[model samples]
Target chain A: MRPALRPIVTLAPLAIVLLGLFGGGLLLGLLQSVGLFALTGSDAFTLSHYRALLNDREFLVSLALSVWVASLATAVSLLLGVTMATALHYGSFVGASRTRWQRTLLQVPLAMPHLSLALVVLHLLSPSGMLSRVAYALGLAPEPSAFPVLVQDAASVGILLAYVWKEAPFLAVVALTMLTRVSRDFDDAARTLGATRWQMWRRVHLPLVAPGLVSASLAVFAYVFGAYEVPLLLGRTYPAMLGVLAERRFSSVDLIDRPAALALALAMSLIAAMLVWVYLRLARQLVGERPVLF
Target chain B: MTSDSASPVILRGVSAAYGDTPVLRKVSLEIDAGELVALLGPSGCGKTTALKVIAGLLAPSEGEVYFGAENVTPLPAERRRAPMVFQKALLFPHLTVAENVAFPLDVQRIPTHQKKLRVAEALALVRLGDFGARLPRELSGGQEQRVALARAIVSAPRVMLLDEPFSALDETLRGQLRLLVREVQQRLGITTVFVTHDQREAATMSSRIALVLDGGIAQVGPARDFFTKPESLAVARFFGWQVLHGANGNWLAFRAEQARLIAPGGDAPPEGWLVLPAKHLFTTDLGTQRLARLRLAAGDEVEVEGPLPYVAPDAAVALALDPGCIREFPADAPATARGW
Candidate 1:
């Protein structure tokens, strides 16, 4: 084999899997959404499914809820993750063993599956859960019924909580890796150059870590936007997340709703792709010809 | 650029450590205003740690650092205003060269026009004026270091600390940068502490060389004194002096250039010279001269630099040392004498 072709050949397995499974599924879904590949024997290609989705208030509400939940979750996670990462990094200087334990504890949520984490969030934040019981025991609440409705609420607070809990640590791990790669000399240099701690963070550290944080937050945003299980377990029934709404339509008893479900999925994919393009452009502007992501 | 008149820096009984391992112990030195002092030592001898203490990057466990008459040890590095250049350029990669040089002024909230003017002057000082708009990655290694030097002096700091700033460069670049640093330092008259393991670098750059050993200063004096009047046997050996045992348990130290090889039965040696019987071991040919290694009768090897003698290997010869060049120390003298 030619040397140049060797790398292509070596990468063939990954390419085949990605194109065959993900690409093929996406192509099929797109065709079905446009009204082809109908089980009812009508093979007409039409935009009726997307047009119906655009006009439907239920679908619009679901779309808005998904956008709201994902954006809030990602923003909260990025902020918390950066804070946690910085704390762990500087905390190591005070006590290495304590920081090590805290780092290990952070990893516990990351190790569990998202569905399992949803259950954990449910047990902690539900009306009759541990927090409510403690509130009642302290007489802050008259009973479990008096506790605020956190789970299965219109705000999707439970789903957002679960995502922030699961994704913050994931983002923290990414930020920490970038932090460790940054030389300590940069900090010392900033200090000697008369930068206070906050100024050092704003000028030196934040820019240095922004690319990694943006990349990780993009991943979390994309994942939380499409995930269904958490919303199914913790969301309101009236206005569900796009993922849960699409899944309900896909599994409906009527065969005619399938195209709308596929349309919703394609819409989600389009939003994610556009977001990724914007993020890539922003990252390019940040680092200036350096490779931010491969 | 308007250079601030430099202030004297003093470290009094400064001791520091990394974690539990102590790096500097009761290390103290006083640098006069506008003087360049080199903390000269081998690797891991705590020279860099001492420099860090002075820069306020590392707090000394014990001792006070004073800038002129003010006790500055309690202040943080940001408040101290003593900038340091590290071994690597360590320019902020994200910022342009001009912005990196303007960082100190930006932190201190200097006026925008003044910051730009000072940054331009600093760049011109380091001969990097045109490269200000470029990023650090666009510059070569030597250029990056020059930008770092520009950044260090841009604020017209009263004191500057350099930790082996040119060590990572090629020899030619190192030589150029050493001269550049010395010229800039002299022109600005900033009190500077330069840390280097290279004795030649120390001798070439510093007004006084402080020889640090075992986490303490063994001696601190003018470069010439390190050779002519080393206080201890260790200080003499460190400066490449050839030490030999003399009669009555005395140790004699002399530079290789101070000793000469004499053929047997040659003219009578000059008065007040110490002559020892030796056998030629071998000769190393340098471009300008040959260095002949000879074994003295007392079983210690010594080098004499000159044109190689006509004698072959193992040929008997007499080595004559000038009494003026030889520093005699009693056998019981301390290996490392404390204080300056």
Candidate 2:
């Protein structure tokens, strides 16, 4: 087979499937948002839905809330992930059996389904759930209700916790792989050159892992921004995440709300597209034309 | 220039093991200050392990490491201040050549101006002054190694450990870098330890060579001593000498170049030389010289190097082994080391 043809032949099937399903649905959704396709009786196209969404205080707040939660989750996960990965790589937590267990434990979240992890987070943080009961039993709170409304709290703390719990492990795995591929001699060289342990990480390991970490963080940020299950289970209804808002609008009994729902979906997709574009540009600057794993 | 004299690196009865596998056993050697010594050996012979022990990267299980009068056995590699240039240049890919060279000074909390001056001087010493702004990936392999050399010497380390730093380069580049390392070491007058499996490289780079066999020093002396007189049968063979089982179970070694071929019915051979009947098996032309392999009457084979117009295969030849070139191993020394 010709070399160029080989790649096209191999990738064609997958490309066709993705473009058919995802691209087709995205096009249909964009058109529907502009009143091109609708089950309701309105035949005229207008920007009213988008303009309404922009002006609607709840929709605007939901979009801002989604961005805030995702950013906070990404920042927390990146820091925790890199630290854990470094610790694991250097054997700060050791013993042959224990090291294996620790590695597996660190990656457990990676294997977990998002909905399942969200359920666990909800149970642990809800007023009447395990953590609240434990706090009450320990006399830290007079009752479960006094433990603070972590689950479904207005701040989306429970949602952030769930996202961090699941996503940090993925970023940690990326960091660990990058660390393992790099030569340990660089660390030794740094130390011999008079660098302290912190300096070694700051100077050697950080630079080595930064590109990979940024790519992974962008993925986590995008996912957290668009993910629905965690926020649905753990977020308040007043300022729901964009995904929840879109879902509620799309599932409403009235059929006229469909275009607005599609509008929100199109907006979210555009935001994700912009994020990916920004990541590509930044990745080129950060990692230099090296083939990005993402 | 280095203010302090080269710190004598001493490893007293050092032994190291990786889990259950012993790599070095009770290895003891002392290198004088300002001396460049090559730890020469085959791959997996623990020469690198010994260098690491001296650098304080690996603490010996049963011995002490000393830098001059200071017993630095407990010191970390950073505390010992012995920088190593690894087989790969290992330049921090993220940093420019200047930053890499200035890393040690930066770590030591030297002022920015002093660090810049030293980095510049070090890069110039390595003949890579113009490459300071370039990243390691931007440089050629030889240039990367030169950058690594600059980094190693920028701090005026107490001891410089080179772990086959030029083995990755081509032969021509290897020779050039070898000379560069020698010039830099002499100019700085710092003690250096070089590890290499290539005999010619070791011989060319160091003032003295320590032949490491089975994880211990088989012999240590001037480089010529290894060629002229190898202390053990293994060392002789390692130097490409032909070790043969001679009269009454004695092991003897002879260099191919020292063995002369004569007619079977020639006049009496010289005194102190052994005469043996041999059949020529093959001969190869090596440009300036001819090498012939012969089967001895005792059913063993030996090689002889002589001028061209070499003998043909299956021809009868009388072999005269020069006495000066032959050395007999002690009766108790193992005839051949197990598993090489």
Candidate 3:
């Protein structure tokens, strides 16, 4: 629209890459005639391999833990993220003060990758880490092992912390960008109608930005749920995340676990699709608005 | 000055600034109980700023605001009994039209049935009955502005502040809404402050117009007098029409309707007449009386409201005006702004 974008016409050539990868994989599945390599010329379709996924304990446990972590992380981050966004957006913190510094500090976490950040958190919270060493120096602990392992703890607080630290800033950025679409006049109008600052934010700003906040939380949920590297580097030994479990199954000595591994991958994809569908359904029903009070 | 004592809303020496830049200077005015006064000025001339200060949205850097003779300068906007109608008619996007008008009642914690009845009455007063179920998106621009007006009035506030509420509407709709505003104000008799960059609209609706500049009132008087007697040259220029100058350079003003065609070297050039070759610039064929804009030899463009006569672009013409039709005063010697 601004006329300066004419040079980006070259990027249209990249459609071939999209068609090659995703389109090629879909075609491979479409061409399959349900095990043509069988000794008998069987003309039957079978979902026996997909149905076999439910009996596996590791896959099921991994699926539950991933959901547990993703839901916990998303809920906690959204609460804090939306609160911070509304405060910074509406509060009286203008013109070269400490608020600008705080905004800058919040963005640094977002600039770093999630894997690097997990390692940083692990270094600080591990038994021989900074917090433990400090406790030992203060004579609060008798020895190094006396301090309980905070990193990769059984409660998954460590994983929750890692997700919140990386994803809250992401949510905040998405929410703040969406906030500009709302009218400031609504806040002013609300105040004139006898609504206090808290009331205005609760009644007006929160409801208006709820859709954006939900979408942002969904975005964070999708990433934290399926993340492979971060969970692999900092996950527990017994109940691994679904991504790590799937990876382990793929690298097995024999290819006997292929069908089960594909089932797990398909399950994770199905959950993510449900989250997206929920967002779309909510978006469709967002037409009704509340009237002003006289 | 004595009549101001009866006013419900009063501002005394109010000054407001943003950071180091002052938006409104020491502005003080009083709105008599059940009267509507238009705070008129150009965009960014501190008109809306004054409205905000009075509404308790912004604390004055100096002076005080009084509602019912009680100092309310320290109060927050929520505590003040003034509801503002913003320029864009900022209806809550999540609320229905009925709910939008009922928002203040909801905040005040009124009963549900009462709110419904009040919202219905408010909607009907704006001639928007049964539009209560519709969203703001479903209404036209004029209708949205009316909804905003309804919301403000439904509060039954002691004072109402409207900041350029009809600016978003087209010209014809704007005039129709202006008349509607006057009719509504007369019926309700609320102490209203209407802020606008339009002088004609202000004169059309309000009982009086406060001509503001530099964050202060330049002149406050009857609506008719503002067009007749502008306090200074700056005030005169803000209004689009002319301040006519006569022989010996006395301050003079000629009414546009008094302008007429004249014969060359007529018996005696009338008082307000300045004979010159007129070139027609534009003409509109209004159903009742067609109007035309013309520029004289002195390059002064005047909008004359009368029946269109035989006149073409670049045509040589003469003007016959009466001296009695013009108002004049002695010029200020130090005022050297010329050819501006």
> What C-alpha lDDT values do all the predictions have?
0.88, 0.86, 0.75
- Write model 2 residue lDDT over B1-340, tens digit each, in one string: 3727579988889999977788998888989898999999988899999998988778788988999999999988888889899988888988889999988888888999888889999999999989888888899999998988899888888999999998888999999999999999999988999999999999998989988988888889998888888887788888988877788678878988888776455456688789888898888988888888888888889888878355667989877887777898765676543332
Compared with the true structure, model 3 gives a TM-score of 0.84
Which candidate do you rate higher for DockQ, 1 or 2? 1
lDDT of 1 at B44: 89
Candidate 2: the clashing residue pairs are none
lDDT per residue as tens, model 3, B183-293: 777777778899998888888888889988767787888877766666666566676445545557665555566666542333545554566556667667788776667
lDDT of 3 by residue, A130-152 (tens): 88889899999997778887667
Candidate 1 lDDT score relative to the true structure: 0.88
Candidate 2: segments with Cα more than 4 A from true spot: A41-45, A92-96, A272-293, B1-5, B245-249, B264-272, B337-340
lDDT of 1 by residue, B1-340 (tens): 4456478999899999998999999978899998999999888889999988888889999999999999999999998878999999999998999999999999999999989999998999889989989999999989998999888888878789999999999999999999999998888888899999999999999989999987999899999999889888888888888888888778888999888888666665699888999999888889888888999999989999877556689889989998998999888765443322
What is the DockQ for all candidates, taken in turn? 0.87, 0.70, 0.70
Q: In model 3 chain A, which range of ten residues has the least summed lDDT?
A: A30-39
DockQ ranking from best candidate downward? 1, 3, 2
Model 2 Cα lDDT, one tens digit per residue, A188-293: 7787777888888888888888887887888888898898888998999888999999899999999888999999888887887786677668767866544355
**Docking class for candidate 2:** medium
DockQ of 1: 0.87
- The total number of steric clashes, by the backbone 3 Å criterion, in model 3 comes to 25
